[model samples]
Target: MLQIAVIGAGVFGKNHIRIYRELPGVHLAAVVDPAVTLEDTPVFASVDELLASGIPIDCASVCVPTVAHAQVASQLLRAGIDCLIEKPFAASLAEADQVLALAGQYGRIVQIGHLERFNPAVTATMPILTKPMFFESHRLSVFTPRSLDVDVVLDLMIHDLDIVLTMVNAPVTEVRAVGLPVLSPKVDIANVRLEFATGCVANFTASRVSTERVRKLRYFQPRQYVSLDFARQDLLVIDVADPAAAIAAFTQGAGLQHPSAGLSLRKLPVENGEPLKLEIESFLTSVQTRQEPRVTGQQGRAALELALEINQMIAQHAERAGLL
Candidate 1:
């Protein structure tokens, strides 16, 4: 059995611990968190204590606060432990680079927790991806005290940013953004527009202060429009039947017989599963095979770079409007 240690027994950490216990061929070796105590599992107050205890840990999940990610990950990597780090990889690029460099020095696998990438809807949409030219994404959540240390862009929007970046596969040529604080001192709502080198355009709106929770992405390609609903694990694709038929329908709008004339609509099948479980399983597979993780540290850094850029743009806009 692979021995696993979970650092940070907070919200996300607890879930990782529980999943490790549930999965076979893996042992929940210990937990490192000063504030938490568990009756069944060994719990240490800090990583230093856990490492000194000689628990024979094979891997660990670093779920500590954003600022501590680098320090904690560096310690574990130097100790020869592979790690799966939680999102917003690090507070800044330097810290992210430090963790990545340590992982490289130690020859350890590093996976970033961009959980939505493992969602059934996203997985289903990957195979059907075309050269998408336009994208519309919205991720909204009701006000919660969790992850208040960062703005809505890092806390929420980073998920979509990672997804879109992966799909577009092009350098971002332009970024324009605006954001504001509502329920928190940091930006609680943001809207961003990104233009890519491939002539693709993406618009994103993320909000933590919302009456309802929504997670959706819709993109339009040459002859297809795909919609993915993250919460429901649903994917919808609409394709034009033919170029001539589509043009005819558009030109003869009043004479069209149906609202969806010359369009073919279908829902893609999604194998629904808990994303966190899948993520942990994938991480274990990587550890066992010594393979690169699906969400590599480099990809995480790319997402972080974009999120930080968007935050900077927001700050600039705030300063211009005298909202800072």
Candidate 2:
């Protein structure tokens, strides 16, 4: 059995703790948090305490604060323990590189917790992707005190960012963004427009102070448009094409705005399940098989890098608008 411990006892960390206990061939070795304690499990004040306690830990989930991610993950990796660090891998690119280098030296599995990639809708939307050119995404949630340390770009939009990066499979050539702080000192809402080297464009809006919760993404490609509801675990694809449209026009304009006489909309089949459960299960599989994870540290860094850039753009816009 693989022995595991959770480094934090916050909302996300508690969820990880619960899921680990339910998965097969894994033991809830310990819960490392001085502020909170879990019954029927040994508790430690910190990773140092957990390491010194002599409990055999095969792996751990680093769900601590963004600032602590690098330090906590670095310690675990150097100790030869595989890790699954929650999203926004680290506070900055330097810290992200630190985690990757540590994992490389230790030859350990490091999975980034970009949970939406495991969402049923996203999984179902992948197979039919063909040069997606335009995208619109909205992720809104009721105001919560959790993850207020960073801006909305990192807290909420990074999930969509990772998925978009994987789908586009191209480098971002330009980014235009704007954001504001609401109900917190940091940016609580943001809107970004990205231009990729492949000529694809994506627009993203994220808000943590919304009155209602929404997690949706819609994109268009040649003769196809897809809508993905992350919360509903549903996918809808619409195919529209002009029979006489030239190959260039079909590849360039492809049903983005106006559909031809022929159009069909249908829902795609989806396998519904908790994304976190799928993520942890995949992490365990990589640990056992010594294979690459679905979301690797480098891929997570790409998302983070873009998110950080968006944060900069937001800051610039804020300063220009005299909101800073």
Candidate 3:
């Protein structure tokens, strides 16, 4: 069994510990968290203490805050331990570089925790994304003080941004964003529009204040419009000849009489299921065989770079609006 250490016992860190404890082929050596304790597992005040114990740890999961990712990852890498750092890999690109460099020098694997890669809706839709022309996504959640330290763009919209870049294989041509601070000094509500060289446009909106939660994506392709409800793991595909046809068809399919005539309609069946375990299994296999992770440090860096650029745009807009 591979020996592993779980750093941090915060809400998220606890989940990691629980998963690690239940997974076969993994020996939970210890859990490190200065602020919390694990009843059955050995508790160390810090990673340094656990490492000094010479407990033969093979890998570790760094579940600390974003600001502490690089520092914690560096310490673990130097100790000859591979790591899976949580999302928003680092506060800045330069810091991500440092952690990635350490991983290369030490020959350790660094997997990013972009959990959406494991979402069933994304997996089922990946095969149908053939030359997407336009994409729109909205991820809204009620205010939670836990993640107020970061802006909503990074805290929420980054998930969709990563998904969009993964689907579109072209370079970004232009970017526009606007944001405002609703409950925190940081951006709590933001919208980003990305234009790619291939003419693919992705518009995304994220908010921390909402009456209900929504995680949805709509993609426009050549002959079909793909709509996914990530929150419910549902997919809907409508086939049509053009945008006008698609809207008319969608309305007609919903039993609404269309005002326009000569509209073609086709309702494609949707596939719904769960695939979160698939991602965890993939991570385990990658760790066991020393293979690259599906969502590597490089992919995480790319998404983060774009997210930061959009955040910058939001900052500029906020400044112009005299809200900053």
State every prediction's TM-score relative to the real structure.
0.96, 0.94, 0.90
By TM-score rank, best first, the candidates go 1, 2, 3
lDDT of 1 by residue, 1-324 (tens): 999999998889999999999999999989999999888889999999999998899999999989899999999999999999999999999999999999999999999999999999999999999899999999999998999999999999999999999999999999999999998899999999999999999999999999999999999999899999999999999887676776777787734335546777889999999999999999999999999999999999999999999999999999999986
lDDT of 2 by residue, 1-324 (tens): 999989998999999998998988899999888899667999999889888989999999999999999999999998899999999999999999999999999999999999999998998998999899999999999998999988899999999999999999999999999998889999898999999999999999999999999999999998788999999999998776544543444566665334443556689999899999999999999999999999999999999999999999998998898988
Q: Could you tell me the lDDT of residue 146 within candidate 3?
A: 72
Candidate 2 at 131: error in angstroms? 0.5
Please report the candidate that would top TM-score against the real structure: 1
Clashes by residue pair, model 3: none
Query: Which candidate achieves the best lDDT against the true structure?
Result: 1
Q: Report the lDDT of model 1 for residue 10.
A: 89
lDDT of 3: 0.83
Error of 2 at 220 (Å): 0.1
Residue 239 in candidate 3, Cα distance off native in Å: 1.8
**Measured by TM-score, how close is model 1 to the native structure?**
0.96
TM-score winner, 1 or 3: 1
**Predicted candidate 2, C-alpha RMSD:** 3.9
Model 1 residue pairs with clashes: none
Candidate closer to the true structure by lDDT (higher is better), 2 or 3: 2
Span of 10 residues, lowest total lDDT, candidate 2: 254-263
